[model samples]
Target: MEKVILASRNKGKLKEIQAILEKFGMETISRDDAGIPEFEVEETGTTFEENSLLKAQAILDEAHTITIADDSGLEVDALEGAPGVYSARFAGENCTFEDNNRKLLKELEGVPEEKRGAAFVSVITMLFPDGRKLVARGECRGTILTEIHGTEGFGYDPLFLPEGENRSFAEMAPEEKNRISHRARALEKLEDMIREKCSC
Candidate 1:
């Protein structure tokens, strides 16, 4: 099987990407697994695509192999996308998931439910040692809830309800959420691009 390095240390994300890549007969491993030392890459990009490429390129520079990276976050329209690229650090650099959620709730306080529009976005970038690159983006539109719900998922999952759904992403089963998640959609597009490239 083809081996690829995923430019992330998050185990939850690694598992998700591994599962998807496995179907394409590719084995996914974290940078640590590939013997690359853990390090932080400052996300100086103003957009998801830029950040994703930054991460993938950073790892590829170190490992000189096929690497995949993604930058994803919640964009709240009510906050004028206040947390767009800063979703992870919305509360602060050292913030925890709960801290971020608390900040979001406080900011949306008194905002009518109808005006609490938001979207989860994911941008995936693949980089090869030969300098080849592929990128894909996906979004899931929804509204931000006044309170958190469900026990599953991380980040802003509990506070965002996908459109046409009564339950938050945290409320759904893992498989169910993965089916319609922004990351999943982005990976699907990435898979198509990979297949096309392989055939070329």
Candidate 2:
């Protein structure tokens, strides 16, 4: 199988990416797995596309191989799309997942369910040593629940109730979640692009 360097250290993100790419005969490995020294790539981009490309390009430069990266976050309509790019640090730098969730709930306090519309967005960028680049975006519409739901998944999963689903993302099984997540949709598009535009 073809191996690709993934410019992310989040284990949940890694599992989601791996589950999708494996079906395409591709394997993804973290920078550490490739023996690359640990380093932070500042997300200096204002948009998901920019950040995804920045990380992918950084990895490509270091490994001189196929590299993939994705930038994903929650965009709550009530918050005017706040915590989009800053989703990871929604509470504050070095905050825990619970802290971010608490902050989100606090922000949405007293907001009606009708006004709780939200969407999870993912932007995937792939870079090749031959100067080829591909970008794909995907989104899943949902609403922010009044309270935390389940214990599975990461990030904002506990507070996100995907449209048409009674349970929050955190309440769904991994296989079920992987089948319909924003990352899964983005990866599907990326797979199509790879099959059509590149040999790998």
Candidate 3:
């Protein structure tokens, strides 16, 4: 089976990516598994696609392998898409997931439920050693709850109520959330691209 490197240190993200790629009969490994040293790649991009490319390229440069990277965040329509690119550091650098979620709720304070529309956006980028690149984007539209719910999921999952669902993402099982998540949608696109390349 072919091996692909996922350019991320977050275990949750790595697991999710691995699970998706497994369907293609490809084995997924992280940078650490490849014995690549950690180095910071500054996300100077103002958009998720740009950031995803930056991270994938950074790892590809070092490891010279097929690599995938993703940049995802929550964008609240009422907040004018605020904390979009800065979702990881919404509350501030070094902030925990709870801190960021807290800040989001506080910012939306007094905002009526009808006005709390938001979307989780994910951009996935794949870079091959031969200079080939593929980019895919996905979005999950929903509303941000006034308060958090569920104890599962990371980041903003607890507060994001997906359309056509009463439960937040954090309340759903991992497999259920994976089925409708922004990342999963993006990965589905990526899989199609990969199949096309292989057939050609």
Candidate 4:
């Protein structure tokens, strides 16, 4: 089976990516499983594509295999995208999901529903040792909820309701949300690219 190494240590992210690839009948390994040494790829790039490409290339060098990397963020309109690339450490280093979410809510307090516009952006890139690469982006446009809701998902899911839906992402079931999530959408595009070009 063809295998993929996902360049992330986040279990939740690993799980989601693994499941999607598996559905396409590809084997996958999480970062821990890939036996990579401790390393950090600086996300100094301005755009998501640049950051994801940097990470994927680093992992391909270390693993010598098809590796995929992603960088995602929550962009709030009112904040003018205050926490786009900094979503993970919005509150500070070692910040918890609740910590970031709490701060977002506070900053968004009293912001009317119409102006609470936002969207989740995800960029996924795949790199191989042979100098071949593919990149794709997915986005979920939604309004930020004033208060958190549900407990199904972590991060800003609790306060995000995808466009045309009344329920927050945190309230969505795994399969349900996966079908419409920003990452999922990006993965779907990658899936198509793989099917068209990579499948043997």
Better of 2 and 3 by TM-score: 3
Report the candidate with higher TM-score, 3 versus 4. 3
lDDT, candidate 1, residue 24? 74
Q: In candidate 1, what are the lDDT values of residues 77-175, reduced to their tens digit?
A: 988887999999999989999999999999998999999999999999988777788898999999999899999989999998999999999999988
lDDT of candidates 1 onward, in order:
0.90, 0.90, 0.90, 0.88
Q: What's the lDDT for candidate 4?
A: 0.88
For each candidate, give its TM-score against the true structure.
Answer: 0.91, 0.90, 0.91, 0.87
Clash count for each candidate, listed in order shown:
0, 0, 0, 0
Question: Which 10 successive residues of model 4 have the least lDDT summed?
Answer: 191-200
TM-score of 4: 0.87
Candidate 3: misplaced stretches above 4 Å? 19-25
Ranking by TM-score: 1, 3, 2, 4
* Candidate 4 lDDT over residue span 1-200, tens digit each: 77889899878777777776786677788877879898999998877889899899888988899899999999999999878988988999999999999999999989999999998999999887777888989999999998889999889999999998889999999888988999989988887887777753
Which residues of candidate 4, in runs, are more than 4 Å off?
10-26
User: In model 1, which range of ten residues has the least summed lDDT?
Assistant: 191-200
Pick by lDDT: 3 or 4, better one? 3
Which residue runs does candidate 1 get wrong by more than 4 Å? 22-25
User: Which structure is stronger by lDDT: 2 or 4?
Assistant: 2
